[model samples]
Target: MAELQTHYPDVVPDLPDLYEPLVLFYERGGEFVRDNAGFLDLTGVLFRPGTLRGHLGAPSLSTLSDTVLDAVDAEGRISYYTTADGQGPLLRRRELRDEQRDELFSRDLQWEPTDRIPGSKEEAKDAGLVELDEIAAANLIAVILSNTSR
Candidate 1:
């Protein structure tokens, strides 16, 4: 975990709770960036069309974005995506393996409502958690703290 703090040093985002993961959803470029604890995990990033295959190396684990977007529950059960875009969309799930201790994959997630009022998809992504606006606010606070640490 020290490696994560040492590497980003000044860019670590604050999370809702110390135990909860902080996820970043990119609007224009359909992608998700996730930070768990002190380690950076990219198992859940998504891509649009077939362009995902071209961008698998740097950001996420796989480059194949040609997957149909589907939603599954945290228990690994097939469930409907409540989100507009997520509805009936076919999605591919990939597990990111860690070489060290047991680590959590970014793919392993369940959608909980964020306090952010939804307008556009981008707005929703930037809004942070569905039920926890405070978490989003904490991330903003983390950004400020990270800057000071630098």
Candidate 2:
């Protein structure tokens, strides 16, 4: 972790207290996007609302699943992860920061919370948000692969 921060100072943020597992999640997500670019392209579901919902089953599930994928896609090397709805935690975090900015402006203050903001790992765990368990991730990947192969 210290090595990553030291070497990739610009890529990795200075969140000293961030949950360790959350960092793993982000790293693993990037690997998945890189490794499965072919499957993602063949499925054509990452950025399409109708196709995403169709592949994932329910609308809410699709939205949540897409949000995670969109986050990874936005920060990944692949250019195909673009989303039309601006979904994902990154967007949500931006929205929260904007709201905080507005509130601070109205109150004539210039302070920002340094701990556990909207998109932090603590908030995610407190909200019971699991970015898909191992079984689910494997199953979804398998489904995409199988469907696209046919």
Candidate 3:
């Protein structure tokens, strides 16, 4: 656990005190753009079972399902590992994040909790809000189209 504290400082914030597993969902090799499905994957980021309590910080595939090809949800959230009988969401809420507006997937593709839910602009500031801009949407379409051509 101390090794994690020494490494991947960026992931330290995610190492909660809880004994349960911690998943750091990624955008699944996709770009950061409005309405992108990969951005919503949650299970793709699981580090490994019991890693949460050990505080072995940073995200890893070990924490998630055994397979990488598993299906991800429309929001980019990974489906629960029913095959592995992994943990499922304790609760569900609809919300957005800042990554939804970025041009690239980089670090911005990561998800974070926000106080506000989707469809409410007023709560954006407090929550890691995602504002849907036409430019962002168009950018996504362009990327998808360009990639398909290749």
Candidate 4:
């Protein structure tokens, strides 16, 4: 287990430069960040997309805007957050369109109303479970804190 730096108050324990891994994680949703404690964050620094591209070796790992580090949650993924484009509050435009088309085209089923569900239970459950299968976990590169000692 990687230990936090307690020797000096000012010194943050050794952390790998995981800028890339984090971005990959975000694309899926920050599942790893939730599971692991003391995941080093490069929050204090301001790294532009271009700079990150140079290091992370990807063009679409991030956007031009800075990251919302605090955004990392148990279900960390893009779908968890509200995006500018409303083409999908559910999925991509084509996928969303297909799903919507299915809903529009299919015969509406007579659903039973329950005390717990004042509205459409299936729709509500589907909406709520968006995070369940939406974002996948990314494989982060483990940092070797011991290497820093040498």
Give the TM-score of each candidate: 0.15, 0.18, 0.18, 0.18
Candidate 3 yields a Cα-based lDDT of 0.32
Query: What is each predicted model's overall lDDT from 0 to 1?
Result: 0.29, 0.34, 0.32, 0.28
lDDT of 2 by residue, 1-150 (tens): 778888998998784643553465566553333123334321222432245448565522222243334332322211111122323111122223224311110111222223223355455546543344323433343344344457
Best by lDDT: 2
lDDT of 1: 0.29
Residue 16 lDDT (model 1): 27
lDDT of 1 by residue, 30-139 (tens): 33344544433323322243354675543421211212111221222111212333221122222234311111112232233332234444554464412212223233
Error of 1 at 140 (Å): 15
> In model 3, where do residues sit more than 4 Å from their true spots?
1-119, 148-150
Candidate number with the higher lDDT (2 or 4): 2
- Tens-digit per-residue lDDT, 1-150, candidate 4: 124545553577565445655576577553322213434433221233335448555422222122222222221112221122322222211124223211110112111212221134355455542221122211000011112224
Worst 10 residues of 2 by lDDT: 101-110
| Cα RMSD of predicted structure 2 | 20.5
Stretches > 4 Å off in candidate 4: 1-19, 22-60, 64-67, 75-121, 125-150
